[model samples]
Target: MGKATGFLEYEREVPGELDPLKRINAWKEFAIPLEEEKLTIQGARCMDCGTPFCHVGRLISGMASGCPIHNLIPEWNDLVYRGSWKEALKRLHKTNNFPEFTGRVCPAPCEGACTVGKSGSPVTIKNIEKAIVDRGFQEGWITPTMPTAHTGKKVAIVGSGPAGLACADQLNKAGHDVTVYERADRIGGLLIYGIPNMKLDKGTVQRRVDLLAAEGITFITKQEIGKDITTEALRSQFDAVVLCGGATKPRDLNIEGRELNGIHQAMEFLTRSTQSLLDSELEDGKYLSVKDKDVIVIGGGDTGTDCVATAIRLECKSVIQLEIMPQLPLSRQPGNPWPEWPKVMKTDYGQQEATKLYGTDPRRYLTASKCFIGDANGNVEAIRTVEVEWSKNPQGGLIPVEIPGSEKVIPANMVLLALGFTGPEGGMLEQLGIERDERSNVKSELDHYTTNVPGVFAAGDMRRGQSLVVWAIHEGRKAAREVDCYLMGSTEL
Candidate 1:
């Protein structure tokens, strides 16, 4: 789709990032954009493989292999290479509702599945995508477009995260009155609070929200279902209801000293930090402070990385991340071949900053927290940890087996649990009499998204459990189509 021999001619190049030491001083996005000419050359690296797996958007061995929203990667790459920036933007928007969000934070499984990457470096698809969309906004090519006509049907979407926003956008485009309800004081759900400002600035999220509002989707903040509003009232008011409320029940460590005063869930730490930052530049002291305190972050994922970065920004004395799993290989193992999301060592932004400052990696692999030790004042003072080896249980499933004489105590005044979420909170689900799957997710079929209730639907993290923002958008768009079909007997969405 790009130059026939562009893959051979051009080496992959991505945008530069600010030095970790300097960037850690402030909470802002630090990725510097590549020039248009360089981005064009990078886009030319998109090979014309007969079968491009970059946009396959399927699971391979339980991991995402490509773009979850099925972005038209090659077409946009070709457009970028041809210097047709406007056309590239249009192609990008055809599949993705918010490229800015995914372009910034998505792990980019699309790059992992790139055809050229099988042999050499892959095309800079993520960077080119961000460039196209950023240019679209800069050139004033993107704007709010009101629906041509109104269907006079109203849809109430619970939750204003990516899923609910995408669903509301699609339903509104179908001429249905769409109103998004968020429990938080602001919209954008996870985008607003769950993610730290350093990764994705709140301004970017709010800009998109503003555009959606201009397009006629109503947004109501600080309105929670089952508490502020009842199920019966919502169903009676709207022609259909879609539950895009995310899976927010965080998994907990049921060990000794779990009730320590200084221990907190990852979301609570991140959410309060962002809120206070926005409210008064953090001078209000409404958020948790780890200044000059040793911090221990549990679980090894994006959330943990974010906690580490936030702690560093807050001037913590020291930070250490605990991971129960073994360290991944430096490159793809034979078992995890091409197109499968590579399980490899990644030094994310947080770890990079930590390495530069501490002269060592902050992660401690194959380590498990035994218990949190507290001071006489009831605040967490330290943590007891143990290294373990993976062993197969009777059922042939792998489990962490504690290694004897490996226990160690580390000083820690604060602990953040980044163990991820279990499932959706049960309040609204229970109130609506919705059935739940074994994993406690909303019981709804893929591509169908209908619950046992006549017009009640579900999508995103609520139905699929915690997932990438791209997947949530895909679910929302699909669910919107189903709701449109249910309402009018068929849909063109």
Candidate 2:
């Protein structure tokens, strides 16, 4: 701790955002970076707890409570407080390979599990994390730690998302020749396409990708295995293969009129929008624009929130989000307890923008969509929905029961299905003869990422279904160790 009384002296301070009305009118990042001196004061607030539960990275009450990658939070906090940014970055990278991505998107469970949070607010760990890595990149202090010699072992990573990239990074550092394959036109999969540019700039992603290329990691784009290139070729060419293919199959809304033109999957909408912005100046591309359209996004998750923000940026005529669950309480639940992920109702940046623009929160709580109503041209024009009530049934289980008089129709020219993902696409897994779990995800044990076939491994969404970026990095690191141990008769990876 910088000062023994620092926590008492400093109240918690989150980064300020751009004026709500002004930011809602644009497609740029809304949160302004904190000044370095202010950030240093925030960093000084860390008590450096004796136990330091912030880095525990464990499962509690069926949810993750701490940093999943087990980041050295206290060490880095101390480093930042001492104005040792270079040291802070080194500590930051000890576990995480992509802090820039996680810093922006992760919910920061570490803050929830913080020992300092037991009585008062937690340290500004996430802010300091982003600041450290961002400054490192800006100062040109981050560079490739290229291997001194190659072990002549070739490895093929079958995805370009966070999991695949992290696995490739660890393997490359271990002297294994690494190659990443992406079906998308770009290198960073979800980072470039699945996520919005305002949250994670594509240029920031490309900057890292460029360095990885300079360090000899070959990126093969527009090359899809089991389709463009056969799985047989992958097995025969690479000494070892790590499948990091993410869960791309979007969960559907199996209701009436689902085949209408204006209705589309959440990934389709998100990907197209990001690509369009990244290459908007170009003439030849397809992207769904929500201009002057009535948008209805079905689902209450992060994807749905993203749809709301993206649509707002496009200046939609109006927007609404539907959720099957009732609005949660603003404060934490007694059942949830401390150190467990607080299941409280906190508005994200996107929803805050929606509320500011619409004069009320756009999310319709305990609401469910029943069917799509389309216009004469077979284009979606509206959606039919119902309000629901969730209560414990006789069997001691909670279920959503619809209310009698809550049925209504909402105008919607575009309806995005942001429900969620079921599992990874099985086409390539079928070709590799990889069995799947009950959920249709690649079959693999939690700590053991090996497949039924020797020298074959799986990680990330493919192995563990859809999850957060921190989990992806964890799974990738473990999968790299498993692959490295297979390549050499050692356990050092």
Candidate 3:
């Protein structure tokens, strides 16, 4: 709304990324921040659509259409256009507890739903968002807002991931005494360990964690709920328990040679690499070193891409990503119209780096790994894969059918399974005797986070299946409101 015809005048511009070759030499984030003027122009591209779908969070065809946290996109874009960054930051924080996290990691569904994107490029919403939050910190506008009064109610969050942090932040805002329990040595669960340092700087996660601590939230690390402290004791001590443990049970490849020495879960490889980098800049050699080794990454989602990128950084000899699913089209299909999630293909950072280094994309679509072939020492040496074709079954469902005579072997000294997660670990849930859904996710009613066990609630991946960090934050905030109401018989959240 800043300029009537801004969309026509300016083209979408995102932050410049370091060259693929130059970036792979180091693990630091290579996305260069945009200048203030360019960001203003990018903000000016926001159209004057009466019904801006960018901020209207909705599920279209079972896929997200806009910002999951429902950020005030138009308002902030206008603020940025008018040179009011502090005001934009204020609006950004009104709905999102952590804009910096989403801005960096989110795929920006809002841009896909942008009105202008129907024909041309969408506004650089994600870059503008990051600019606003980063400037807020630079200008020293962000600080602790400790509550003036206490409600004497205590909340024990079972994880320190995005969901847990958002829940803890909201509960603290409502004057409730909140304590976050993390099983890891560091506070941030996935933000610190699961996501590599290059994507999300560890210092950024720690800064927000420290700010929450200053706002009167107590964080205890290395405290497992069912192990370090009994579930009954936790329930008895805290007024309410919010389970944000996340869906961390990685889907396993149960084929032969799965127990090989060089086969590992994506999280194990990523977590160890980040921890080692932070601990001794990789001098300790505690992580799985893939240098000069042939790496095979199975799965094509973000996790798989991260594995590819990490392997590239480790200077692996060769890397390949296998996805059982067919390759997505370069452009949106006819059925997927505007405002629906675009079904177009995207090349992530890892794929780009692989392409630059290998002279080709490392992704091999419609291919599934059948089994891992190991050496005499029980270490993975190669992977046997077969091409797959999708055929409609009797029930009109598409199923993968292996193509005969398509089996091939590829060198693979290291195999990383990035097949995503099934659900939350059942240890704490089993100890608490909480009910689970058909998919093994913690069962909670729609719009309400209360589990079968009273005084215990679940949210984030624990309630919903594995989802984006933005959805996790939304779940956390919504759960915090429900918990607040349950505690005080009302809520001002």
For residue 472, what is the lDDT in candidate 2? 93
Q: Candidate 1 residues 1-493, lDDT tens each?
A: 9888999999998889999999999999999999889998988888888799999899999889999889999999999999999999999999999999999999999999999999899899998998899899999998999999999999999999999999999999999999999989999999999999999999999999999999999999888999999989999999999999999999999899999899999999999999999999999999999999999999899999999999999999999999999999998899999989988899999999999989899999999999999999999999999999999999999999999999999999999999999999988889899999999999987579999888999999999999999999999999999999999999999
Which tens-of-lDDT digit does each residue in 261-331 have in candidate 2? Answer: 89989889998888777776313446887889999999898889889999898889888999898888888
Q: TM-score for each prediction? A: 0.99, 0.97, 0.99
All candidates' lDDT scores? 0.94, 0.87, 0.94
Model 2: worst 10 consecutive residues (lDDT sum): 277-286
State the local distance difference test value for candidate 2.
Answer: 0.87
Listing every candidate in turn, what is its Cα RMSD in Å to the true structure after a full C-alpha superposition?
Answer: 0.7, 1.4, 0.8
Tell me how many clashing residue pairs each candidate has: 0, 0, 0
TM-score of 2: 0.97
Measured on C-alpha atoms, candidate 3 has an lDDT of 0.94
What is the full ranking by lDDT, best candidate first? 1, 3, 2
* Ranked by TM-score, top first: 1, 3, 2
